[model samples]
Target: MPRDHSHDPGHHHGHAHSHGPATPHPAQPAPWSILRMTVTARLAAALAVSAGLWVVVLVAMR
Candidate 1:
């Protein structure tokens, strides 16, 4: 689709576009509930993978 480049002479090109919503700070840890849940999920996934690999090794040793 072609963008409309049509402009009115009344529209000033000198206008600045410096306005937007503020984002959350990266340094700040997320909410306790959210952070705790995320950590739990990651740890669970890690432990699951480790256990799976360990089982594979054990079965191979047999």
Candidate 2:
């Protein structure tokens, strides 16, 4: 019986085999620093809570 030569390792059909060494990416900044909320955010939160409290107080007083 004859052996098949279609699955030889010497043939690649013009495809890349080596990708070379991987380079390390630059360090990233702190995720908290990137998404840190400012004073305006706090003010908006306070205002929302104040408005909600005022509405509840008015409803209770009624």
Candidate 3:
């Protein structure tokens, strides 16, 4: 019968592994930062652009 080394702490699996939260690789883009615009600011800008588009459409329809 083969011995079970899977449960042995001293066993080596010849593979890399982690036991905690995975970290982002250095090549990946950083997460959002405080320096970026806030949700409210983004919403306001989107609304402004939408309003401008609506105005253009209304004028074009005339």
Using TM-score as the yardstick, the better of models 2 and 3 is: 3
Worst 10 residues of 1 by lDDT: 17-26
User: What are the lDDT scores of the predictions, listed in order?
Assistant: 0.71, 0.74, 0.78
Which one wins on lDDT? 3
- lDDT tens string, model 1, 1-62? 97565575456568554543275434655565535567778799789999999999999999
Q: Which window of 10 residues has the lowest lDDT sum in candidate 3?
A: 17-26
Clashing pairs in 2: none
lDDT for each residue of candidate 3 in 1-62, tens digit (9 for 90 to 100): 99988889778779665543376534547596545979898888889999999999999999
Total backbone collisions, model 2? 0
lDDT of 3 at 30: 58
What ranking of all candidate models by TM-score puts the best one first? 3, 2, 1
Q: What TM-scores do the predictions have?
A: 0.41, 0.42, 0.44
Q: What lDDT tens digits, residue by residue, belong to model 2 across residues 1-62?
A: 99877788766657664544375545667666514778888788789999999999999999
Quote the lDDT for 48 in model 1: 92
